[model samples]
Structure formats: structure tokens, C-alpha cells
Target: MTLRATIVRPDARIVVQFSCGAASAVAGKLALAQYGATHDVQFLNAFLASEDADNRRFLADCEIWTGRQFTVLRDEKYGADVQNVFLRERYLKGPHGAPCSKLLKRRLLDAWKKPGDVMVLGYTAEEADRLEDFRERNPDRPVIAPLIERGLGKEDCKAIILRAGIVLPYMYRAGYSNANCPGCPKGGEAYWRAVRVDFPEVFEARCQVQDELGPGSWFLRYRSGPRKGERFPLRELPYGPIRRNESLPSCSFFCEMAEADIIHKEPTA
Candidate 1:
């Protein structure tokens, strides 16, 4: 989607991209508090089929906590299926990014968004750089980061949710930090090993996708050794203990840095 500034609407909408994560849930509450009186604040969640089913339960709980309904959207082309994107796009992780994000989340949001619409993202103060990167990349897109502005981080968001009497998504309770896809391509070997244990079906399904897409769809790369920087197949990934504290940032619009620890390149178009 080619982005350009549009003439401001007299009654512009405040569109909060709610990703069913703690930060976005709190961001929605904050946005409603700050702009519900003056602006038409709406929550939008681009539902991903690969995300933990508990995310849907969390979404409903968050709606009650925020006292607002969410307009959940699905990818028209891929039906919000991460595996479908990987198969059709014939790619997964790359210097650009995983196609699942571009097809399922980004494009869905772009289609629903309009120029002059104020976008409230879930970026926290700790993720200020990601917010800036998003702004630099899409200068025309007006954004309001309530969490960052409030100086809240992931832990703070979690606390706020609990204080509201809302249960965190099962993904968090299951020891996964972010409520992302069960077998998120951004995860490293250790993370995948955890998936192998927790969500064996998802791990096996992703391995099947790799088999279909060939080597290009591999999601892991060796960090140090003779084969460093080479893509590693998930099926061959060795089993290992997962760090209980291994936390990956929740993936959302403008938070592509989830892959920063692994790959660095210009943002995907």
C-alpha cells in the first residue's frame, strides 16, 4: 500500500490496532480514556489463525475491560492463515520479512485504514525505536502511541490488565511472552524447541510447509560455526530445554524489530 497524507477529516477516527497482546489491550483502554470523548476510537484486530486460540478469549476479556467492542478482521486472500501466506508467497523469513505478516496483518490493516485516520499502536516506551522506525518509514501515517507516551512497558501492561481483572492470554500463561503465532518464524532454535514441546502440531505443520517450500522457507539460521548464517530446517532442529524466561516481543504493526535480533535489512515494502 503506497501511503500518502490525505486531507484531514473534520471528524477523523482513532483506530487502535489491537493485536490481542497485553500492550495493545492496555493501549486501547488508554486511547479510549484519552480520546473516547472527543474522537471515534475503534479497536481493530487483524486476527491470525496461527495465534493461540486463547487470544480470542483474551480479546473478548479485553473488550469488557476497555468497555469497547473490537472489529476483528481476517485476511481476505489468505483467511488469516500464516501457513497459507508462506505457501503462496513461496517464502517465510528473509532479509525483507516473513510474508505472513505482510499478507495477513499489514495488508489487512492498510485496506481498512484511511488517510487522516489516527492510528494507535501498541508500542511501549521500551520500543520507542520501533515506533520511530515506523514513522520514518510511513511518514504520512498519523500515529498515537499511548503506551509509549505513558512510559509503560510490557510488564506494566500486564499488571494493568490484571488490575482490571482480565486474564492474560493463555500464550503468556503458557510461558510464551507474546501471543504471536504458535510457531512464529521469528523464533530461534530454543524457541522452536519450546514450540515442539508445547505446540507439537504447529511445529509439525510448519515443518510440512518447509518441505513444500523447500530451503527458502527455513526460518532459522546458524549463528556460529562453519555453517553460520545458513538457514536451518525446523525438522532437523535438535531438541533442547527452553529457557523459562525467554521472552520475545509481541509482533504487531510497526514492531518488525521482533526479527531484529536475527536479521537486519531495510523494511519490507
Candidate 2:
């Protein structure tokens, strides 16, 4: 079915994109507190098949905590698989962004968005550049980055989620910072190394795909290190410490919001 066909309610003007991460859960709570009484707030998630099973558990807990049903959206086109798109388009992630993300989420969000609806995203204070980039790029999407606005950090979000009685996702327990898909295509040497220890089968599958994609097509591209711009396949990735401790910045519906912002900013025909 098309994305527009999945809209049971076409008029939810206040929408929250729940990434099923700690900060996202907390952001949804804050949005509900601010706007639920005055507007019909809707919570939406663009589903990813590669995500851990415990992400569902976290989603369930957030539903209970927020007292609202979270809508799970899928890209009917790609069926939410990055590999499927990679194989079909003969391309994996590029320097600009992930094709899987654009086809699945960014496009879906565009089709699902209603005119004048407010989009709530979970971006923490540390991601000031991303927040600025988003705002600078999309000046008319009626978007709100609550965590950034409040100067809340990752730990603050975790504390709020725990106080509300929601257990963190299993990925967190396993020392993963962001609850992105297993073996996220954008991961680095440190990230893939951690994935090898945490999920071997996933690591193997990613390696196989990298081999299939040839030497130039790789998941990560290093900028400053010895290997700069060269495709660093997961197969050769050495075991190392995970990136920047166990703390990572909040996950955003990055491309989707950017697309919406740009489209809405255009002069209407």
C-alpha cells in the first residue's frame, strides 16, 4: 500500500517521530505534556527491520508511559531493508546519506505529513551542528527539537526514562549507544568491532555484503585517519573500543525532516 493509504487519520496536526531510543521516549513525553491538551498529538515511528528486538520492548514501554498508541510506518516500496535497496539500486550509502533512509523514511514522512502539522524531533544539546543544519535548511516545517531547546543531554534523557519506569533497550545493556539498526551501514571501525562482539551473525552478513559490493563499496569511509575516503569493509575491521564510551547522541529522523522542511519552504505553484 502507498504511504498515503496508511493514514487512518489524515489530520493529526501535532506529530512526534519516536525513534524508540531513550531521548526519543523522553521527547515524546515532553511534547505530550506541552501540546496534548491543546492538540491531537500523534506518535509515529518509521519501522526498520534491522533494529534489535528489544527496540520493540522499548516501544511498548513508551506506549504505556505516554498513554498513546505509536504508529509504525514502513516504506512499502523497500520493505524497510537497506540491503534490498542497495542491491536494487546497485548502490549502498553514499557521502550525502543512506539511500535506505531516504526511500523508507524521508519519503514516507513526506507522504504522511499534513499541511501545517508540527513535527517533534528528539535532538540533544550536543548535536548543535545537526540542529542548526536542520533549522537552517528547513525554515518552514513547523518543527521543534525539544531536547536541544531545553539543553538536555543524553544522561538527562536516560534518567527521565528510568524515573518513568521504562527499561532501556537491550542494545544499551550490550554497550551500544544509539539504538540504530543492527550493524548500521554508517558505522565505523569501532562500531563494527563492537557489533562483531555483540552480534556475530549480523557482522558476518554485513561482511558478505561488503565483499559482494566490491572494494570501493563499503559501509564506512574514514576522513582524517590513515585510510581516508577508502571504503573500509567490516570484514577487515579490527576489534577495538566502541566509539566514545557508551554514550552517543540522540537519533533523529534526519533526512525525513530535512526533506519536509525544504519542500514546504518552496513557493507554492
Candidate 3:
């Protein structure tokens, strides 16, 4: 199957988000194939100090695949540090999401985007529900979900990335689902335990951040599931939990909060 019929305004710049994952890489390549020669298209990433170095290598390989260099967009004010986000914002997440996502990613998108740019995301067909939710929640965003449009799945994306001669990010090889921050709060007990084993230093740093956030502030907060409000300290987690077949939420700079300047959306004062 081919991509959906897309029209690129000659003057509109296409802003493709590369999250250092296979799906995003495939989306970026398809965007270039469709619009790069005739339109202004650029790839962007919200870098974090906490992301794996493998992410950088994957990005470099993707750059070669696209034949275009990425324009790295960062929120210098936050220094893109997860711990800094907790200390300054005084919390990890709120009604919206983790503060680090808003400050580092959404804020920069807010600053860099303009009227004629269309934001493109790599939500594969497997994520049709998320794509639908994003469309419903963000009617104002000039965004395109290409993978879903093309009926591609995660495995399809992996094949596409391999066909381009690029290696998948190390985390994917190491058994993590996505190449998000090593200690991303979107993870659960099992995910954190994996982090403790695969990324010991990152695990220690997140432990420090959780302590700094004080009691009751944690990575996992299940409101309705069996693990309701399970905010157990990562320090106490045993290694046996690491092998559970569980999932972690995917992280996107924009999708995390859906909007920048979420001061009014803060759950805490």
C-alpha cells in the first residue's frame, strides 16, 4: 500500500519529529520522498541529556537515509535535564504529564513552529487509537500522521529502517519498546526494574530525582488499574519484577502535553 494523498503547500514547511525510533525514521523518509524536493521540509528532535548515546547514532544514520541534516531544537533554559525539571517545577507529572516533557519539548515546538509548517508524527497503524485521540484533542495542530495513513505497523517500520541501512536504537535491541529517556516516568514497575539492570547509572539518577520530588511523587500512578496509585520508590524494587510482560507508554515531545506553555495546566501551585 502507498501513503495517503497528501498535498504540500509550496510555501509550507514540513516539520517531521524524529524520536530516534524506527517509526519516526520511516515517517521522516516518506515525508522527504513526498515533499522534500519541492517544499521546505526539515526534521527536528528534542534532545535530552538522559537519552541513550545509541539514540545519537541512530539519528546520524537516519540523517544519511533522508539526505538532509536534522535541525536540533532544544529548550536551552531547562538544559533538557529531567532532574532540573523536577526541582524547578517541583513535580514530575501533573494532570497533564511529566514536567520535563513540557519544558523541554513542547516549549521548543511552541517557539520554533510557525503558520505554514505542518507537524508530522510517526504513529504506526498499531497506534491508530492514539492518532485518533491526538486528532480529537488537538484539532488546531496542522499535523499529519503518515504511518497510520499508510497502514504501516511497528514491524513494517523496522523493516523500512533496515532497508535504509540504518540500525535500530540500542534500547530496542536491549528489549525496551522505544528509545525514550532511560528512566522515563511513563514506565511501570517492571520497566523501572529493567532500567535498574540495563541502565544502572540512569536508574540511580532517577532515584535521586524521585527523592528530590519528595514523597507521593512517583513515576507510576495508576488511577483505575489493579496497581492504583502505585507510587512505590524505585529503590525498593526487586529484580524479579523485570521480566514481566508489560508495556510502557510512548513518549513524544509534543504529544506528551499536546501544547506548550502549560503553566495554567499545572496540577500544583
Candidate 4:
């Protein structure tokens, strides 16, 4: 008996979610290159018309490599504005993980997705929970995780980009784990600590936002109770020089907040 083979023709439109991070952007670029080479797929950037030069550069590189003119869906107004609203309402409380992901990244994708187009996410197998969550949330559309399928983790992604003679995003070299934004409210103490050292201005701005939101609005809570009768340290901690080879710290505190049921009931919609 002979087995029958079924081949699904590639869709004309493909959206690559670009977060300006090393791993995700690289994965998106690779996907675009592959699809452009093999099919009649048009690459779409989540934030194509934004003023961000870095985002523009990434798109330009994709076009250069693929030799195809990709269409960009402009949604500049909604991206940052909605993200700010989400952060102020939902994430300003305790360690709710980066609201920017929900507001800017995922929201952009949801808006741009069409009925038959394949949505490619830049998640690797290393982010198992995230991958599962993406699939669960967007069950209607077929979401492809090419990097995850290839067993390419963060390190492997970096190698791929470097081998292509492309420079990784500055945020990666600046010690950010994933580039959502500068001083994201979802950042943990260690992440903040690193930011305080690497990007002091951004860290200070985040503290200012926390201050304006008042008590209980702060993202960072002492893991352990404060020293008995001891006062909270109002001043910023002196962060040491970051090591180049040092692995970026995970947003562990934000993850805990989700588990601990500490999210504020602010409607994202």
C-alpha cells in the first residue's frame, strides 16, 4: 500500500512579529528569508511605520536579503498608546509581566491577521509555556513556530544572525533578556538592577512612573519581608558593571505575580 502525501500551498501573506530583540527578531528575519525564497509570501512588520530606526533597519535588511518588497501595515497610533494604557492600568500593580507584549506585540498581530494567512511567532522551545499560550489563545489562525520546531534556542538564534554578518540589536548587547521596551514595568529586581547599571535614564524613568502610581502600584516587592522595623531603601542600588558573557536574568518576579494572582483587574480591551 502506498501512502498519500498532502501538501498545503503557502499563503500569499505572512506576518513576522518583530519585538526588536535578538532572539525574536533573528527568528523573524530567518522565517522571512525562507518564505520569500520558497513561496509568494509578503512579510509584514508588527510596527512597520513607527519612528523607531531599529525596527526600520530590520525591515530593510529583510527586504535586502529576500529581494522582495514586503508590505507594511501601519498601526503606529494604537501600538504605543494602548501599551501605555495597559501598563498604567494592569501592570503598574505588582510584577505583572510586560504589558507591552500584550498591548504592542500580540495586539498588533491580532489586528493584522487575515483569514488564511499563516502567523509566525518567534518563540523557541525554551519558552514552552509561552508557545502553548500562543497556540491556546489564537486557535483559529494557524500559528507557526519554526525556530521551536528546529530546536533553536536563544544561543542558536544568536549564532544564526552573527553568521549572516548582521549585528544583533543594541538592547541585546545592553544586557536585556528580551527587548520589549526600555525599563518595562514587568522587570524584576535583578532586571531593574541590571537596567540601573546599564541604562540609568530608563531605570530612573520607570521609578518615576512607579512613584506616580503610588503604593501597591510598584512592580517590585521585597521577595522576603523587609528587615524587622527596617526602612525601605528609597535610593537606587549601586549596580556593578555587567559582564559580557553573563546570561540575561529572566523576568522571574513577573512570572510569580501571574501565579500568585496579583494582577489588577484592568480591562485590556
On TM-score, the leading prediction is: 1
1 against 2, candidate with superior lDDT = 1
Model 3 residue 60 CA deviation (Å) reads: 1.2
lDDT of 1 by residue, 1-269 (tens): 22223343548898888888899988889989988888889999888888888899999998887888899888777878988888888877776567677678776777787767888889887888877667666666677788887789989999998998889988889888878888887777889889888889988999998998898778787777798888788998865668533666567765542343224444456
Give candidate 1 regions above 4 Å deviation: 1-10, 244-249, 256-269
Clashing pairs in 4: none
Please write out the lDDT profile of model 4 over residues 1-269, one tens digit for every residue. 12112232564455555444455556666666567666555455445222234556655665665566655544454545423554456444334355544444445555666667765667665765665654444454455666776678888877777787766656666555554454555445566666676666756665665566554454444445444333222134434444433343222212332332333334456
Per-residue lDDT value at 220 in model 1:
84
Q: What CA root-mean-square deviation does each model show from the true structure? A: 5.0, 6.8, 3.8, 6.7
Candidate lDDT values, in order: 0.79, 0.72, 0.76, 0.52
**TM match of model 3 to true structure:** 0.86
- What is the per-residue lDDT of model 2 for residues 95-211, given as tens digits with 9 covering 90 to 100? 555667677777777778778777777877776567667767866556766777677888899889888877888877776776877766666667667778878898787777777
Clashes of 4: 0
Q: Candidate 3: misplaced stretches above 4 Å?
A: 1-8, 221-230, 243-246, 257-269
Q: How many residue pairs of model 3 clash at the backbone?
A: 0
Angstrom error of the Cα, residue 49, model 1: value is 1.8
Instruction: Provide the TM-score for each candidate, comma-separated.
Output: 0.87, 0.83, 0.86, 0.69
| Model 3: colliding residue pairs | none
Report the CA-based lDDT of candidate 3 relative to the real structure. 0.76
